[model samples]
Target: MAYQVLARKYRPQRFSDVAGQEHVTRTLLNALAQGRIAHGYIFSGHRGIGKTTIARILAMALNCRTAIGTEQRPTPEPCGVCESCTEIRAGNAVDVIEIDAATNRGIDEIRELRDAARYSPARDRYKIYILDEAHQITDAAFNALLKTLEEPPDHVIFMMATTQPEDFPQTIRSRCQHFSFHAVRFEEILTQLRTIAVEEDVIAEDAALALLAEAGDGSMRDALSIMDQAIASAPLDNGKARLDAEQIRELMGSVPNTVFERLMEAISENQSAPVIEEINRLINAGNSPSQLARQFVRYLRNALMARIAGENSELLQISPDERARAARSAMLFSEEDLTRFLQVMLRTFDELNYRQEQRFHLELGLLKLVHLQRLLPVEELLSQLPAPTAGKGSLGGGPLPGTLPRLQAAPAPARPAAPAQSPARPAAPARTEAPIAEPTRPAFSPFEADRDRKITSEATTPAAASAAPPAPQALTPIETAARAAETRATEATRTTETRATEKMQPAAVVGVAEPIAEGALALAAEADTAPEAAAGGSLDLDRIREAICAALEREGHNTATALLDAGDWKQSNGAIEVTLAIKKTMLALTMNAEADKICRNTLKQLGVGEKLVFLPGEASSAAAAARPRAAASGSVQAAAMENPLVRQAQELFRAEVRTVLDLRDRK
Candidate 1:
């Protein structure tokens, strides 16, 4: 006899020998045990997942001669030793007729089958008609057999095996007992392959068997056939076939997933040059662009599954090694990124089918992965906008983005160095002190009414301001007299308790920006003494803006309140104006009619000026070269463009206004 392939040699001879179709097998066994065999049966599933095999086994189980005289078989499984079972297993059973419906699927064939079903078994207990690929039968042929099939003779059994059960007429299917089978799982197929390898004396690596099983794609026969081909080509060592993963991959012309793993790593690291170089190398090495993209799509799918269900889960059909590699690749990206990569590669694979330049398209797809990694949403970029200070995102508060608070906790003045022994610290790390300490000061927001609540006592002390000036500090008599009169007037206005407190004020106060620079201290001293060079003029105007914001909050104008409160305040020409530090493009949103109304009511009540004024903050001004004149679009878009807050928002987020909806008519 010619050497048989693994699929034929290992073909299941009994229902009990079948794998991954327990539902159909168990049902058939029970029916045979109870002597309740049906006249007609339909077995349907994937092409190689035991549809025809189970049909043949069921025939043997029904006609096995072990229980020829008995009412029911003790074991529904075929007795392989019996003549009837042996003949059926050998495919030469006299009573069993196997027809390839694909070749003879006309009404004439159906009529002949109908005539044949009328006869009894020649020798076995029952005659069986097995039609393989039954779906190939025409609708007319199915109709011709429908009557006989609805009531087949008791001594005959009709078994039809098909991959596509839907193609059979509803009449034919309704009359038969339909058993839908499922594809064998990865583990089951792998287990079966391992058993075959051991029995065949093939020394195969587990990874090689895994590769065959994955290639099988849920079909056991497909896996076994691949294994048969692999064994023939596997190099012989000590008269035993030796198989490895790389050998199997070479045979299949599939790139190892590790190659894709490396590609993904380069992509995650934004190494576009390396990514393109790798693709070019793979193409130069005789890897087909289409095949490479196909494998990449599979690799990406596995990575996506590994991302969702973890690397060790049953959800991934890959072997343990590939699963691990896929998981490592998945870890480099977020779940969304993995999903996006999968979608991109899937489209790339699709494009490879008809495109003339497969190499260029595949490289473009891989490059897209690196490009997608750099994409930032407008909202995210806006969130990353700098706060008050450079490299710091906070305005004396933690609402903004930055790691200053966490960094300050480590390098703060209170945290001593590990090897230090002295209580007094050196100024070696002094530069680190100025930046980390200033912005996170919680009480120093320029927006709040009590921003001066933690004023430095030494910087504001009248007595300290009046201390004797050195000879280097030139001062005319008029300047000296003016300073004296200023100090005296401040003293006269203060109570006795206030005067004594100023005399003893501490150098630093808690919650103030710590480690104030010497230059700032001198500047504050000058402002306090001379009262001539204060950068922000007097505090009274600042007080006026705060009062108006507070009034708006009380009036339930929270939007206006937050807006006005986040800005700087200045009074000029007897008019109080608030400079809101909102986003430049979104400046339009802040200047809506509603804002205008709130501003008018609040500033009017404060008696600052007739018209409420809004000044763009420094960030808003810096975003655009100058405020753009509103274009002549429709009123809604024109208004959106004209509103200072909306324009400020556009600039802040660095987003373009794609479409504007008119909600005036909408509820």
Candidate 2:
């Protein structure tokens, strides 16, 4: 006989000889023993797994002469020594016919087969027809043979094998029994390869055989085919062929996963130079950039799987050595980090498919892995901030609500730029980095030190203020720091109000260059609103009320403005009192500090003092003491610009208030 490939030589001869298909085999054996043979059968599954082989075995069993009578044959298996079984096994039986559906897939061919299946068996007890690649049959052909397949002759049997059971029409498949096959597993393939090696007298190392089994990827026929090729290329030792893992890998054009694991180690360490050097060396050794990228994607996928499901989990489908190596690499990264690395490599593999500069893109992808390892998640950054203190504000007021603490910007020394190195490998890379200039520390900040001193000087008594800064009691460092921060925050707020006041006024009037509470608050309401009421200027009580009402409307306090406008507004000692026309309960709800926030903000905008008081009464003139009043003229904007300070600004800077935006919503 001519030299036969191992795939055909060691093909399964009986149901028990097949590996990893006990489900299909056990059912077939029971059916045969009971003589409950089906007229038609379909086997479907992955390529190179015994779909077609099992179909042939079934044909032999059905036609075996000695096994026809259940009394003669002790087992359901075919007696290979019988004339009918021998002829069927050799593929020349008169009644057992095997058809390749890929070639004869037309309606004409199916019609011919249907006509032939009607006839009685020529030699064996049953006429069996086997169809391989049955999925290739056209819909018309399947329709043509549907009736014949559904109701074949008593002596006729049909068997079909396919990889895609879904491709067959439901009509054709419904008339047949489908035996779905599973891929042969790793251990089964490994055991088969070992048995084959020993039978062939090939001296294969254990690692070499393990590599062949993994490369098979769960297909017994594929593994045997590869082994046949490996043996052909194996070097001779005395008389037997000697196989090594490296020799098999070279023959298969595969880079051992060890190379990829080394690359992963370089990436986890963030060693750019090593990653680049390794790629250069691999390419120099004749590894294609695309192939290397493809291999790396597989390696990264395994590592990510190992990170998520432990190394021993079935999710990592690899040899024991590879699993251990994957676990080691997985330890170097978080699950998220491994996920990102895998994503980058998968994209790189796809790019290498059509990219002109494969090597360059591959190297850039590896460097990206090194860079991605340096990223810090937002949650981690937020975690580094100080936690909020419970109870009162740092300055002992209402609680401060937010995720972050108040940050203090101290004068930090300019840090000399450290030498360039990978974050994962603190000592490597050694590339030159630009020096970071030290931050300049001024003697005093325009807002901080000066403002603190100004606050200290505003005290009624220096000893009273210096002895105890807190109103209630002395505080710890946390509390004291909180108080100082609160003071700075308050200073910033007052400074903002002063700037707004100055904008409404011009340079001629004394615009609030200081905080309103300092000295600006001492002025009467008319002096603050109507520029004519400044220290020596003249402004009427009615004009002050109009200005305050207009300001309230601008601040979105329409209800307050309408109600307060109905009442008489009087200004005395910088305090504006509004005696509203409502019940006492309604009075408190409408005028509490929180509810009256709009009124306070409006007063501030008109440059009036922030103090406001609400009383319940009617708006008739008899409800309050008399105060001089004047009917105001001109629009509110015109009056604002009429301020001496505002007119001065317009004249000096040639500016005008083009538009105004309410920013309190965001605040």
Candidate 3:
């Protein structure tokens, strides 16, 4: 006999013989025994999953004539030895007609089949028609058979099998009892492969058989065919056919499990050199880069499933040894790291088809995995950082903690007074005098000693300011020193102004040009000494309110300042009770905490005793008091422009007032 492929030689003859399709088989068997056979039936599922096989079994049960007495009736289990059963299994039965819809899919073929359905069985009890790949039938053909299919003769049974049931029209599908077949499970395919290996007397390792089953991808027929090929290629050692993992790997052009294990180990250890070496070895061995990526993805998927579902999960399709290995490997990587590695490999697989340098992409992808597995999660790294400390000059203030304090300009050295010139002869010009030698000062000093001396002289001696200094006939070092001092003073003033503008707030800028006098510094020092005395002495309600508003404006709290400035203040029970308009209530509530701190600090600095209190009042009264009583719109604009707060805001924001509105007019 010619060599028959394992797929056809082991074709299922009875319902029980079909693997991984018990649902369809059980349903058909019950229908046969209960005498509930439908005139038309459709079996739909993926290829090689027993859709056509189950259809043939149903046909055998319908037409079998070997059943006698109690078995005479329609039997679920057909005896394959009977003449009718044997002929049907052999595809040579006269009564059971098998048609390939792909070849006979036109309207004419369907018409012929429809006409033939009217005839009784010639050799069997019932005429059975099996249409394979029925979805390939033309629309016209389906339309032609619609009526006949719905009302077939009593002795005829129509059985159709298709891999794609969606291609069949609803009218055709609704006329038949549809049964959907599922893909065979990994375990089921593996078990069947093992059985076939034993029956063929081929020596194969369990791991090799498992790989064959996985390569089949949930198809029993494909697994059996692969096994048959493996057996053919196996070399006989002492009359025992030898099949091992190495032979399987060579036949499939697949990387061995050891290579994947080494690669994963290198990644876990963050060793890029080993990973690259393994990839090069696989490439030199003729394994395609794209195929390597796909296989690695499969390995990662198995590892992930093993981690999440343990070794017992039905989703994992590896042998016990491989499963245990994956579980141990999974512990070396975090879930996040595993997920990232899988994503990279999958993306690399997709890019391989479009990329010209596929090997380079694969190398870079594996390198990325090696580096990524060594990274700690963000949460873990954050937990390792030192906690922030709390205090002034710590990260809890205006400036960031650890920043250097602002530098102060040193005072200029004192210079001796110039000697009095003789009045008898014409006095030498100021420029002819020798220049004074003064100690060097920092470049940031705002003023020179010469300017200060001149100012003091003018202040003390009114007559001396009116008399101009005499000009010298020849240039002298003394006069040159004075000129240089003036230039240096000007440059220093410019530098100080620039620094202040960059660092200080708008309110602070207002006083940038005003130098703090010795007397004022003395008063500030005193105030710092006795805050309570200062607060009690300056506790006037109006003064306290103004100080609070000024402090708020300095901090860029314009809205809060406006709200506080518009409030009506009254002193009662050692507290300043301020009533705000209804519209400002929400603003006050939002800024309560910040405002309280600012108010307390300002009162302490101003030596004010009164505590601040905020209250919401009727809009009518508050609005009447807050509104500017301007006689005309021009006056309102003038007042708004003249307001110090508005001027500061304009300077701070570099904005201009577009329009001004009168609150009274609004009412």
Please write out the lDDT profile of model 1 over residues 505-573, one tens digit for every residue: 422111111112110100001012112212324335544555655555444444455455445555553
Candidate 3 lDDT over residue span 77-173, tens digit each: 8877788888888889999999999999999999999999999899778898999999999999999999999888889888899989999999998
Better-scoring candidate (TM-score), 1 or 2:
2
**Candidate 2: segments with Cα more than 4 A from true spot:** 68-72, 377-667
TM-score to true structure, per model: 0.59, 0.63, 0.59
Clashes of each: 26, 9, 10
lDDT of 3 at 347: 90
Each candidate's root-mean-square deviation in Å?
18.6, 17.1, 22.2
**Which prediction has more favorable lDDT, 1 or 2?**
2
lDDT of 1 at 43: 91
Please rank every candidate by lDDT, starting with the best: 2, 3, 1
Model 1 lDDT on a 0 to 1 scale: 0.67
Candidate 2: worst-modelled 10 consecutive residues by lDDT: 518-527
Which stretches of candidate 3 lie above 4 Å from their native place?
68-75, 374-667
